[model samples]
Target: MPRTESPRRGRRPGDSGTREAILDAARARFSTAGFRDATVRAIAGDAGVDPALVMHYFGSKQALFVAAMEFPLDPAEVVPRLVAPGVDGLGERLVRFLLGVIDELGDANPMLALVRSAVGHPEAARMMREFLGEAILDRVASAIDTDRPRLRADLCASQIVGILVARQILELPELAAADRETLIGVYGRTIQGYLTGPLESS
Candidate 1:
C-alpha cells in the first residue's frame, strides 16, 4: 500500500488566526452586549473556540476589551507628555491632540464605537466612565495645580465627550461642517476655563 497522510484538524493552540477570531468576536460582543454583559463564553462561542482559549489569549475580560477596542493612541503615555509641559496652553494642546486623533482615525476610531455603544447601554456607559476617569481625567486632574482638580477634569471630559457625541454620533451639521481649527479655538477656550480659570459665581 502507498503511504497515506492524515488530514489536518482544527486550528493549533497558538494560531494567530485564532487570536484574531477571538478579537473579532470580542469586538462584536462588546459592541452589542457592552463590556459587563459580554461574557467570555459567549465571545468564545462567537469565535468558535473554548472560553479557556479566550482567557489564555487575553488574560482577562478587561484586557480583552482593551485589545478589542484598540485605541488610536495610548492615553497613559500621551496625557503625561501633554501635561509635562505644564498647564499653559494645555487646553489647546489637549483639543489639538484629540482632534488629530479623531481626524487620523476617522471612522475607525474606537472612541466613536465607545460613545455609540455607551448611548444605549448603561454597562457601556460605566465602562466609558471608568476608562475616562482613570486613564485621561485623573491624569489631567493630577497635573493641574489648582483647587478641585477632579471637578476640572470632569468638566473637560464633559466638553470633550459632548463634542465627540455631537460630531461623530449625532452628526450635528454645524459641528460636522466646521473645520478642525475652528472647533479647536472655540472648544479650547471653554476647556481652558475649566482647567485653570475660576469656577466661582463671581
Candidate 2:
C-alpha cells in the first residue's frame, strides 16, 4: 500500500483562513470588551492562535481594531480630495461626500460600529478622537488659511459627529426623514464657516 501523508491538522500560519479567523475573533472581542480592554492574548486565544501570531499579523492592537472594523472610508485618502478643490466650497463638498458615503454604505457603515464602540469606552473614544482630529479634521484645517485651526477642526468634527449620531445612530425622525440635499445645504454652510469664518464674534 502506498504511504499516505497525514492531513493538515490545523490552520497554517499566515494563511487567509487564519487571518480571517483572527479578524473574526478580534471583532467579537472588540464588540464585547471595547478597545481598551480587549487584549491581544484574549483575541488570539479566541482564534485558537498564539498572541505572537496576532502581533505578527496586525502589528498592534490599533491596527487590529482597524482591520476588524473595516472602516468604510479612509480619511487619509479623503482629505486630499476635499482639499484639492480649494476651501471655498469645502463644506459642501465634505457634506456631499459624507452623505454620499452614508447613502452608499447604508447598514454597512463602519462609523456606526466605531461610534457605538466609542460611546461607552474611554479608550475607544480616544481612538476616535485621534482618528478624526489627526487624520481628517486636522488635515483639513491645515490645508486651508485660517486662524485657530485646531478649534475649527474640532468644531467641524463636533457637528459632523452630531449629525451622524442623530441621523444614523439615534435615527431621529426629523433628521432621518430630511432630504440629503437639505442636510448638505445646512451642514455645508456651517462647516464652511468653521473652516473659514472669523473666530471672534464681530
Candidate 3:
C-alpha cells in the first residue's frame, strides 16, 4: 500500500471561531497596546490565526477598531450633528447623540468595556484620550469657536467620561433611573458651560 500523507491542520479561513478569536485578541491588544500598536500581525499571532484571516474578517485596522469598540454610529456623520446646532446648543446635541447610543445598547454600554479595559493601560489610556479629544469632544469645541478651544474640549470630555463611568459602569441609581431628557438637560447644561460659559473669575 502507498504511504498516506499527513493531514494539514489549522483553523479554517473565515470560521466564526477564528473571527471570535480575532476579536478577543484585538480587545486585548487595543486595551493594552492601543490601536496604533495593535497591528494585524500581532493580533493574528495572539489569536493563533493567519494575518490574512484578520484582513479577510475585517477589511482594515479602522474597521477592526469600530468592531471592537462596538461603536453605534459613524463619528464623521454624528460629529457633524453635534455641530449642527451651532455653539449655543452644541452641548445638548452631543449629549443626545451619545446617550442615545447607550440607550441603543439596552443593558450594556460598549464604551464601558473600552474604559475598563483601557483605564490601567497607559497605551490604551492614551488612545482613549486621543480619540475623545481629537475625534469627538475636540471637534465640538473647535466647531463652536470657543475661547479656549483645547481647554473647552478637555472639559467636555471630562464631563462625559464622568457620566459614563458613573451612570453605566458604576451603576449609580440616580443617574441610571433618570430619564433621557433629564440626563441630557443636566449634562447638556454642564457641557454648555464648558463649551461657552466663562471659566475664569469676572
Candidate 4:
C-alpha cells in the first residue's frame, strides 16, 4: 500500500477522511505530474484507495481536478447553473458567479494558487489553460448560438481571468477598492458583449 498522508490542506465542504485523503493525493499529483500527466489510478494509488472510490466521490477527472485545486465551483453543478440561463446576459451571471466564488471562498480561492503556480511552473500553467480553456470556457462556448463560439468563449474567459489577476494577484487598489456591485455591473456588460454582442474587425 502507498503511504497515506494526513490532510495537510483542503476542505471539501463535508470532507470525510477517505475523501480528503483522495483530495490530498490528487493535489500532490497535480502539482507534481500536472493535469495531463496525472492519472486517476495513480491518484487512487497515492490515496491508498480504490480507483472506484475516487469516481464515487468526485465523479470524473475534471471534477477531481477542480476539487483538488480547491476551487469553489463544483464541476458537477456549475454547468447546470450556467447552461440553464442560456445566452441571455450570461456575462453578468458568469461574472457574478466568478466574483461570488472569490468573495465567498476568500483565501481558499484556487485562482490565487493557479497564478502563483503558473509563474514558475509550466505544467501548472498548462493545467490552468486546459481547465479554464476547455472545461470552463469551451463548455460555456459550446452552448452559444453565435458563429464563433470559441471566440466568444475566449473573450469572456480572458475578461474574467483578467479580473482575477487584477483583484487577487496584483491587488490593484482601484479594482480591489471598487464596490462589488459596480465592478460586477461594469465587467458584466463587457462579458455579456462577448457572449452575445456582434463582433468587430480591428
Candidate 5:
C-alpha cells in the first residue's frame, strides 16, 4: 500500500482547535515577545490557523487580555461601594477590600501568577494596564468627589500594585510577613491620603 497520512495526523491544516491553539501560541509569544511585539498574525501562524480565525475568536487584543486575565470581582460592582458617597475612610476601606480580596482566594488566586507574567511579559503588562484602567480605576474615578479623581485613582492603583508586587510577587519578608491588620492600617492611611488629601501643585 502507498504511504498515507493518518486522518488526524497533522491537525487537518485548518483545524477548529484554533482558539485553544492560538491561546497556547499566544501565551508563549506574549511571554517571549511581550505585548507590543506580539502580533495577532504571528500568534495565528504559530497555532497553524488563519489570522481571521484569531480575530474572530478574540475580537481584539484588548478583549483577548480581558478573557485571559479575568479577575474574581468586577470593578464595576466593587468600586462603587469602595468609592461610595460620604465615604470618609476611603483608605481603610480600600485596604480592607483589597487585602480581603487577596486573602479570600487563599492559595488559588491567579493574581500572583498574573503579576509575575506581567513583570516579565510586555504583552501581559499591556493587557493588565487596560483591565486596570477600564475596570478598576475608571469606575473609582467616576464614583469619587476628589479633585482630578482619575489621577487619584491612578495613585491608589500605584500603591496597591506596589504592595501586590512586593508582597505577593517578590515575596519580600518585610512586607509579606507583616500581619494583615498592620498592613491594612498602613496601606489604608496611604490610600485615604491619596483619595481625599491635597494634591501637590505641579
Candidate 6:
C-alpha cells in the first residue's frame, strides 16, 4: 500500500519565504510547462511545500494566475492619454508609450504574462479579451468623435498589437533591429490613417 501523508503536513502559513517561493515556482512552471501542465502539485513540489498549501494561499489556479499577473497601468488612464489633443503624432507617441510601458512596468506587464499563459490556457485569453474590451476599446470608442470610432479604435489596436507581438514578443528581424525613431516613423503615419481616415462605405 502507498503511504498517505497529512494534507497540511508541509510548510505552514506564516513561513517567510512561502509566498515568494510559490510565485517563483509558478512563473517557472507556467512559462515552461504551461498552465494546464503546471499543476498545483507540481508547483508545490517545486516550492518544497504541500499541494494543499498552494490551494490554501491561492485558492484556485485562476486566482493564483490573477495574483501572479497583476499590472501597474490603469487602462482607463492609458486610453485617454493615448488620444490626448497633441497625440496626433501617434506613431511617436505609441512607440514612446510602448517603450515607456516596458520601462515603467519593468517586470510587471500583466499583458505579457497573459500572453504567455494564453499560449497554453484558454481562460487567460478570455481574460485578456475582457480587459481589452472594457479597459481599452470602450473608453477609446467613447472618446473619439467619428461615427464609427469603435471600428477605427479596434483596427488601430490590432495593428499596434500585431506590431508589438511581432517585434517584441516574436522578435521579427527587421522590426526587432530597427531603432525606435525608425519604427515610429514607419508606423506612425499608418496609425494616423486608421485613426482619422475616410469613412468606409457599407
Among the numbered candidates, top TM-score falls to: 4
lDDT of each candidate versus the true structure: 0.84, 0.81, 0.77, 0.80, 0.74, 0.68
C-alpha root-mean-square deviation, candidate 2: 6.4
Ranking by TM-score: 4, 1, 2, 3, 5, 6
lDDT for each residue of candidate 2 in 102-156, tens digit (9 for 90 to 100): 8899888889778887987877776677656656777888877868888888888
Higher-ranked by lDDT: 4 or 6: 4
* lDDT digits (tens) for residues 18-68 of candidate 3: 777778788788767766667889988887778887898887776676777
Between the candidate structures 3 and 6, which one is better when assessed by lDDT? Answer: 3
Q: Using lDDT as the measure, which candidate wins? A: 1
Residue 6 Cα positional deviation in candidate 6, in Å, after optimal superposition: 16
Q: Which ten residues in a row have the lowest lDDT in candidate 6?
A: 1-10
Per-candidate TM-score against the hidden true structure = 0.71, 0.71, 0.70, 0.80, 0.65, 0.59
Residue 140 miss distance in model 6 (angstroms): 1.6
C-alpha lDDT of residue 10 in model 6 = 58
**lDDT by residue for model 5 (1-202), tens:** 5498533224443576656666777767766675556688887777776777778887876455445454565555677777775448878988998899898886677777777777786777875676677767887777668589989989999999898888876789878889999998989999888878899875
Q: How many backbone clashes does candidate 5 have?
A: 3
Between candidates 1 and 2, the lDDT winner: 1
Q: What does each candidate score in C-alpha RMSD?
A: 6.4, 6.4, 5.2, 4.9, 5.6, 7.4
Model 4: runs farther than 4 Å from truth? Answer: 1-21
Clashing pairs in 1: none
Candidate 3 segments whose C-alpha is farther than 4 A from its true place = 1-29, 36-64
Over 1-202, each residue of candidate 4 has an lDDT whose tens digit, in order, gives: 4476445333343556878788889988987787777899999888777788789888899999988877776655786577677888778887787788889878877778787788678887877776776577778887799789988988887787788788888899999999889988999899888888889775
**Lowest lDDT 10-residue stretch of candidate 5:** 5-14
